[model samples]
Each structure stands twice: as C-alpha cells, then as structure tokens.
Target: MGEKQPNERLTSWFVRSGWSKGELARQVNRRARQTGAHHVSTDTSRVRRWLDGEQPREPIPKILSELFSERFGSVVTVEDLGLRAVVPVTGAGEVDLPWSGAQTVQLISEYSRSDLMLNRRGFLGTSLALTAGSALIEPMQRWLAPGPSGTPTPILTAANGGEPHTGRLSGPELALLEQTTVMFRQWDAHNGGGLRRKAVVGQLHEVTDLLQETYPQETTRRLFRLTAELAHLAGWMSYDVGMHPSAQKYYVLALHAAKEAGDRPFGALILSDMSRQMIHLNRGEDALELIHLAQYGSRDTASPRTAALLYSMEARAYANLGEVNKCHRAARLAEDTFSDVRTGETEPDWITFFSEAELNAENAHSYRDLAYHSSRSPLYASMAAPVMERAVDLFRVDETHRRSYAFNLIGMASVHLLQEEPEAAAGLAHQAVDIAGKVRSERLNTRIRKTTDAALRRYPSVAEVQHLSDRITTALPEYAAAG
Candidate 1:
C-alpha cells in the first residue's frame, strides 16, 4: 500500500513555486483553456488527488509541466515533478530541523515553501508546547556564538567571472527592496497585517528565487541581510494577523538568514520579536527567556537604541510575569538608555523607529497590563492613561501611524473604564473603532474586543457602551471575522 505514496518531491516543487493546491489547479485549467482544447474543469480536489499519487489524463500533465517550468526557471518534466505512477516517496517532509549554515539555508527555503501549504492546524498558536523549548534552544546557542566572519572556502564567483549575471537582481533592485521595506513598516503601522501580508510574502518568494541563483559573495551577504529583514517583516505581518505558529516559523527563518549574513544585530532584533510574540501568546516565561537571549547575543556592541529596545522588551516580559519590581527596573533602564542617545551615532536603521513615542506607547501597554494583572493598583492605569494620551498626540499628525493612535486610544479607553468613567471610555472606543476599518489587523481586532468587554463589564446598562459595541460589530466585520 505504501509503494506508490504521497510524493515529497512534487509537493516541495509546487510549494517552492508558491502555488496552493487550488492555485495549481486553476493554473492548469487556465493553461488547458489557452490550448483551445475542450476546457478541462479541474478542481483543487483533483490536484490533491494528483498529489496523493493519481496520475492526470493526457494533456493535463503537459499543461502542468509547462506551467511549473515557466515559474521555476527550469525544465520541469512530469517525472521530475513526481506526478508519474509508482513515484517513490522522498520521505515525510523535512523531518529534521537544521543546525549548520548550509542546513540553515536549506531550512529557510523549505520554510518559505512550506508556508504556502503548512497545515494551520499544526501551528502552536498561544502555546509554547509544539516543539517545547527544544525547537529554540539550539538556535539561541548558535546566535550567542561570535558572529562568523569570512568563510575559508574561496568566495565562489559566478560562471561569467566576478560580475553580476544579467538575469540576477541589480543593485538598484536591491536598493528598491530596502525602500519597500520602509514603506511596508509604515503600512503595517497604519493599516495592519491583512493589508500587506501578501505583498511582503510575495517579495519573500521572489527573493528566494534571487537567492537560488549564483551571485557575488559580497552581493550574496547583502542579499542574505535583505532576505533576513524581509522575512522578519513577513513574520511580523503574520503575527499581526494572529497566525502565531506560522509567525514563529518565519522568525526562526529570519534569524537563521541574519546569522548567515553576519548580521548579529538583526538576529537580536528578530529574537526580541519572537519574545514579544511569546508574550502576546501569554507565554511569559518564554518571553523572558527569549529577551535574555537577545541581550546576551548583542551585549558585546549593542547600540543605545538597540539596547533600549531590548530593555523595553524585557520590561514587557517582566510585567507579563507579574514581577512588578523587575518590570519597573527594566523600564527605567530603557528610559535611561534612551536619554543618553545623541547625534553622529551609527544606529541600525530599524531602531530609529523606536523613538520616545514608541517607547511611551510600549510603556503604556506595560503599565496597563501590570495594573490589570499583577499590581492591581488603580495608580498604574492612571499613569498609563496620560502616557497613552501622549502617544495619541504623537501619532495624530503622523497619518501613517493611525493604527498606533488606535492602539493608544484603546489603552486610554481601558484606563478610563478602570477608573469607572463609562462615558469617557465609550467615546474613546468609538474613536478607536472608527480607525479600525482602515487598519485591518487581528491585533487591533483583539483590542476592539477588549474595549467592548471592558466597557460592558464596567457599566453593562449604559446605552452608549452598548451602541459603541454594536458599531464595532457592524463596521469591521473581517477583522472581527464576522460573516
């Protein structure tokens, strides 16, 4: 029964080309139509059956062959694609996780490809249990080692000598990618993950193509850094959309790519990001461990801004863990580091986004969390309320940051609810959800839910609170996942 089994080769190729089962079917059907033959009405089920070892009838195979060949930049025979009858099983997926540089490269490629088809049911979500702590332990160890310098093996040149191949991405294209990353960050801040998820993922797919082709060593290193950065962005976008398991996978891929690029700093940032994801998932211990990993990895030469960001994340973890004193100490350290910053310093471009506004917004969230969960002091919310107001004021003129404004408004509204001021809370909730339409984010949706729940619980009989909740339900159906 196992002789002719599910073909791993075929599945990998299809995923590498970024085709969903449905997409592959659609492409084949479209190709058949272009051939002027009787239109083949193929469904994703047919494609799934094919993946499960059912050979297609006649010209369908030819059509698929051409489609994959064109997209993958090579000749893809039906046999090569593992579509023929009695094709051997190439083992069940990539069963082993990677460790070395070569293995890491292979791992990232597999990961991006799997992303198109990874079963959502298998993701860890809010739990740290899937691979347990083992999944992260090895990578963290490698990240702590001094960043690798030049390899001893002669830096291999492309076939046509040291020049960039005509088919490869030019310097301008790479520069444009950096520019696009900036735009993506801004878009994510204002609009949310759903808006740019596909765009960043698409860029990542194209970059995989670039990485596959031969390029200069210097170019390759820079390209790896870019790939790492983009992958982190893609991961962040995924996390923003509530795809936590998938987000963790992408972050791991980004961390590996950064290490390969000799970019220890970006690796630290990605680790810190993973920690934040853990905290969001309510896995506080995991968050603290990951933050300490970041600090350990970057301690040798972390810039003030990077240090500040790291410390801020540490504060977040401590607050989540209900360690009020640890949280306060970390937050104060972050503030002190920020205060010491001056001009003429070379900082990672990504950290510049973490200004006083960003820190205050983060601190506001920490204070709010501490108030609600651990300290249970009305004082925490009172402190958080003004800081959140300050964040709103900062984000107001920066139209590209309306989502941040929305977040701060949500926090501020919660603070008012804590103070038993229902009208003030309802008014802010109304304003926050008004902008929620423009920012299609699951995180923001969670905030909406939180706001509604808090408002209702604080003053259940109040008409304005009821009306605001109804408006939220009506306006942002998709974020709410309402049919």
Candidate 2:
C-alpha cells in the first residue's frame, strides 16, 4: 500500500466497503448505547471528522472497530480506522498503541466509568507479555541487584510550553488512582500476588517516571510518596511470590521515598508492613524492632485508630517472642487507643477502614496469638475459634481479607487437633481448605496445608480429613513442595 493521508485512507476504506460516513457513525453510536455509554450524536459533520482523520476518544474508536469487524466479517483494528500512523502493528501482527501520558489518563478515566466494558479485562495484553518475559529468573535477579556506585540519574524537568502543571491532582484522577489501587490489592489478596506483580511494578515505574519528569518539586514530592506506596505494594506482591530478597529491595526503596516525602505516617505504615514480612520470615526479633520503630515514628502524628493498629502489631510481635505479659499490655493499649477514636476524624487514608469491631477483632488475634505461643492447649482451643469467627465476620466485605480469616480458621483447627478433637478439627480444616480453593492466596493455602498435614498425621484414620488434605495438595503443588 502506498503512503496516503489518514483521511484518504479512512474514506477509501469506507467507500470500498459501501458504508456512508453517517451509517458508520450511527452504528458506532448504537454500539456505545449497548455498552451503557453516553450516546454520541451521529451527525454528518461528526462522521466527516472521522473520515477526516480525527481519532475520537476511547470507546468510540473501539466501537467503530467492532462495528466494522461485524460488517465485513473480518478483524478490524484502530489502524483501519485511520490511526495506523499513531498505532503501529506489533511483531505479533496486532495493532499496538503507545500508552503515553495522555493515553494513560484517558484509559484510566474510561476504566473508572465502567471497568466491565473494557475489552482487555484482568491484565493488559502487553502487561501479560512483559510478565511472561520477566518470569525468566535472570531478569528478576537483575532487578534485585544493588544500586550502582555512580550518582543516580537526575529527574527530567518538565517542558516550559507543555501542559500546565497542577499542584494537586483532580478529584477524578485521585479517585481513579484509589480505585485502581483497591482493585489490585483485592486481586493480590485473593490470588497469589505472583500473577499481577510484574504488571503493577511496571505501572509504578511508569508513573514514577512521569511524575518525576513532569511535576514541580512540591508536586513531585507528593507524587513520589504515592509512587512509594505503589512500590511497597509491588514488594508485598514479590514477598507473596516467594521473592523475599527482591521484596526487601523494593521495601527499602519505598522507605527511602516515603522518608523523602516527609510523610511520617506513611513511613510508619511501610515500617509496619516490613515488620509483617519479617514475621513471615520468622525473624521475630527483627519484626519486633521494626514494629517498635513504626510505633515510635508515628507516635505524635498518627491518629488514634492508627496508633491502635501499631500497638496491635507490637502485640503480635510480643506474642511471637513468647512474651505473654507484654502482649497483653500492648493489646490493652491498642484497645484503649481505639476507644478514643472518633468517627469522621481526619485519619490517614490507609487506616480509615478500621472501626470499633475491627479493633476488637485485633484483640481477638492478640489473644489467639498469646494462646498459640503459651502452649495452653485448652485456652488455644477456646480463644482461637471465637477470635477467628469475629475476624471472619468483620472481613466478610473484603475479598482480600478473606485469606487472613481463612488462615486464622486453619489455626483454630490446629488448636482443636492438639486437644484431640479430631472430628471438630477436621470439619474446620475442611472448611478452611474449601475457602482456600476459591481464592488465589498462596499464604492461605500454605497455612491450610500445614494445619491439615498435622491433623492427617495425628488422626490417620479420619477419612474426611485425609481426602481434604489430598485435595489441597493436588490444588497447590507449591504447598506440597514446601511441605
């Protein structure tokens, strides 16, 4: 095909297919309505603009492509809609559009309007391909390498004549960011963070680059803090994926960014997350140190609810260290702090979801933890069930928190098994395993495996427990390997 003007190409395609501009516009509008989108006017002038190489925003182009595909009984792409120059063909013979700043903003806005309507659901195709590429151990190894000796590259200054820099993000943009964060968090919680870690990490890299290159210093600082939060999330995903060292590096980087942002509250939250990771690694001493750091760092600045959360974390550390008295003291402090928490107070965005019941649930966990470490077998059996039940009730609204609830149930089951209540323990263990099957959480699955393995070992004659254990083993190969 000879090089031709975009308008000429569009018009030629329409002519050869015997479609008038008006008809195409009508078809596009009809499809948009079907998707519950605002119907664009199918006037002659609008159609003329499309034939004149004007690329209508998002859904319009997508709708046109779909309509054309249906009309011609062949694949129609953005290129065939007079945008071949803007969107080039990939090596895989698919039309690939560059997701630049403007495009990202637009896509995000569209997704906010109706995520269900977006053609590329779950993960973007490009993101999926990049994740597959990064699955090779070497690439991840490189990302985990130490920083270079030379000074880091300076961030690029925004262009003088470029778009006006807004000191603060618009409400819509902020909402979009928050929504995206929640969606990814839920996905991470239910599923092993492995599946979407690379994609979210890539997004953090992109957003960080854009913010640094385009924003003013003050805006850049705030943006960097948000970027750091995303980085922390990426690290959490890495930790969930068994890439502990890589996760540590990301956490360190996030800590540096948070400190630079002068956001003590956020820094404390990151520290709390770091402590949790340490606990997972069985570094109880290290976890305790980090939890103390978090409590101290946010002592003056944190809200009552946040303070309660920090204290709860400290209690967990104390429990892990087998300090029952200290654990009880911290748990009481958490409860007292939570009692003073007021509704509608300007709390940090991170802990806004915590309520009185949630605090009680934390106390429950503290009791359960204390029971676990104390080897008070009957106490463990008694407290574990009620605490886990309360936690599961509170977390029912959040799919991501469901795994934690499930893990707690598994713990309760183990406690029952220790008391020689094999029948009761087997029933609870089976329930935990069943819930674990629906979620993508490796952590929850691992917890189930451990509890069920113990139960099966102790009560070899329990057929139901044996079958549940076998099913869990088959569903999660990693759990079997780790076992």
Candidate 3:
C-alpha cells in the first residue's frame, strides 16, 4: 500500500548464489512443477517483484530456501533471507515438543485453537513451508526412545486453589466421542475433507480441553488415543483440501498423541501417512526414508494388514524413484503378507479400511508412478491398467468410498492414455469428472484437471480428447478460468 523497500537480505543471497534473475525464476518454476504444484508459473517479472520486497505466496519462499541451501552447499533458511515475516508460525503450538506426556495436552489445546482461528479468518496454514523429509529423522528417533509412561499432569486453577481433579467424563461420554470419530472417518471417505475439516478441528479442540482434567491411568490412555485419532483425521482432512502446512503440523500432533497413548502401531501408521504426503509432493527420497522408519518401528507390533499397507507405501516410494525391481519386490511382499491374513483376526478399525480395494488401489498407484518414471512407458502402463481396473471395480461397489472410486478412474485413464488409447482414456476421464462434481475435494479437482490437461496435450487432434477437454472446461470452470 505504501512505498516498498528493497529486500536486501534476499538480494544478498541472490548475489551470493551468482544466478541471474531469469535463472532463479526458471529454477523455482521447475521445482514447483516437480512437486505437482501445476499452477505455479514463476516468471522473471515475479522474481523482480519479489526483489522489490513483495512476498510470494505459500511455497515459493520455501522452495527458494531449499534451492539456496543446495547452491551454497549449506543450510539456508527463510529467516536468513528475511522471509520470516512472510512465514509466520501464528501460535505457541509450533514450538518443538518436549514429548513429555503432559505436553501432549498443552500442544493439542494450543494447536487446535490456533487452527480454528485460522479457519475462521479464511487462512489455512499458508504461511509455512513443508518440513523437509530428512528433518523428521531426529524427532522419530525420539519417538522410539523409552520415555515416560505418559501419565496425566494437573492444570492449576487460580479460582480453585486446592482442587485438581474436577475434569473427568463418564464412560458413555467417551463412547459417544469415539463413535463421532468413526462417523467423521466415514464422512471423509465419502465426501472428502473440504466439507468437515473445521468440524474435526473444533472436536479436536474439545478433546484437548477434556484432557486437562485428571483421570485414572486407563481413562487417560483412552483419551490420548482419541486425541491421536482426531488429530490424524484433522491432518488428513487438511491435506484433502490442499492445506499442506497445516496438515503437516496436525500430523505431528497426532504422532505425539499416539506416543502418549503408547500406541506404537498407530504411531507407525501416522508416519506412513506423513510419508504418503511427501510422495504426493514428489519428494520420493524423503518418502522412502519415512516408510522405512515406519516398518522398522512397527516390526513387532503391526498387524498383517498394517504391514501390507506399509509395504505398499514402500513400493510407491521406490516406484517414484524409478527403482522398478525394488518396487516389484515390495509389492510382492505386500501381496504375500496380505494373502496370509486369516478371517476374523483382531485388527483396529483404522486398518480395516485397507482391504482388497485399498491394496489394489495402492498397487495401481505404484505401477502408475513407475510408468511415469520408466523409459519404457507402455510396458509399465500395461501392468498398471488391469490392476487399476480391479481397484476401480472394487471401489465402485463400496458406496462409502466414492472419492476413491473417482481417484482410481483417473488412474485408469492415465494408464489408457499411456497405451495410446485416447478414446478409452477420454471415457474414463469423463466418469472421473462426473464424480468430481459430487466430491468436494481440492486434490481430486486438481487431479482431474491435470489428467484432462494431459489428455488434451497428448491427443489434441482427436475428437474424444476435444470432447473431454470441453467437458472439463464446463465442469471445472475454475481451472478453465485459470488457464
């Protein structure tokens, strides 16, 4: 609004890197595309604007820090470049956790409150960069350490000087809360997170408040596990709507809650979820590290289905890295382990969702990535097609999972596209578009647009491709407008 000042800190770093303004812009754009942020298109003009002390939105500053760090062969941060003003943490919740049992209560309370306020203000954790994949290693090591048993701590009140045990709930109340959690999970699976992420955040806020009251040891453990599940749900919802930094923070809180509850298997699952996000962002090496950590940590405790899920994620990471043989090996391990699962074996509800449908979906995803990475695209695409078809068939029968059904259709279209079947690809893409209208998911919308765009690019002269492009333009008007 006023006369702007030059960003001397950024300029100094830019000069030290010895890259021209155009080069910097080009590199930043390349990195953004590599992460699947397809809408980002940094030009020299934008770089010049940044030099004039204008802040770029969301992930640009984060990308610049990583690029600078690489060029200098040392760590460079947003703070060192005076971009901290743009990347605000907004609350005390982000302070590195001490991992003590009581800190879980404090962290959830503070973090959820901040999250709700941000939602009210129409801001959804857009100021922070995604945490580096390697950055999580030390924190994970701390998670594996045998620490305190996570007993509850008292919260002092000024009004009641001696009273410390007033905040307890009856068993029915806890049961109702757990039931609400399951309902939320089902709702998310069907409709995506855009519709109810705020509701989940509010519930998490209430749960953290309940944790402040002292309870018996067993009750405390149950409350903490609920906290973990809610936090994980909150994170998943945020990711569904593309609020990535917020999702990452929520996931960290969830992992902390799981640790306090002494739920090691669920903790491993949280790590796997984080790895999935990393893979979505195209950080394959970082994703590989996280999946490995999950597998190692859950070795003695994980159920067969959980192990199968972890192996599938490992295959995805390897596929992303173009390691076809390793991907196959992990995929086979996942299949073998899953085939051995006996009926009626006790398993957690969180894991029961990873049935044949989800497994095939994951397998299809791995081969799709391999198709993208391989020089022999048709070879891998052929492998992906039938698996993806089965995944789509399985998903279609489950009414609670329409969003996943739409996602698999897009994958099937991708496989067809790679095999030079534009007409078939267009048909599947049309079904995905129809489902996208019913699903309120930012990620799904983006994927549909991306897949359709690819189809248009590949077969621009084909009538079916033209029709698909026209359909997408009508259905996803915002993407059309952006173009």
Query: Each candidate: how many clashes?
Result: 0, 3, 0
Looking at candidate 2, what is the lDDT of residue 435?
68
Give the TM-score (vs. native) of candidate 3: 0.78
Cα lDDT of candidate 1 equals 0.71
- Give me candidate 2's TM-score against the actual structure: 0.61
> Could you tell me which residue pairs clash in candidate 1?
none
TM-score of each: 0.73, 0.61, 0.78
Per-residue lDDT value at 107 in model 1: 65
Worst 10 residues of 1 by lDDT: 85-94
The candidate maximizing TM-score is 3
Tens digits of per-residue lDDT, candidate 2, 1-483, equal 653334654565577567876777777777777777874656668878767666677667656655654555433444434553122111311112221323323333332222113432321211111111112212222222223343221331332236576434554674576567667776766655655775676566555545534455555555656666776777677566444444554565565556545566777777777677666656667678777777776778888888888888888778777788898899889989888988677754556646654565666666766676776846754765676566656666655466655665676676677567888777877777666665555556556766777778888888877777667645554231221
- Residue 432 in candidate 1 has what lDDT? 88
Where in model 3 is the C-alpha error above 4 Å?
1-96, 148-165, 477-483
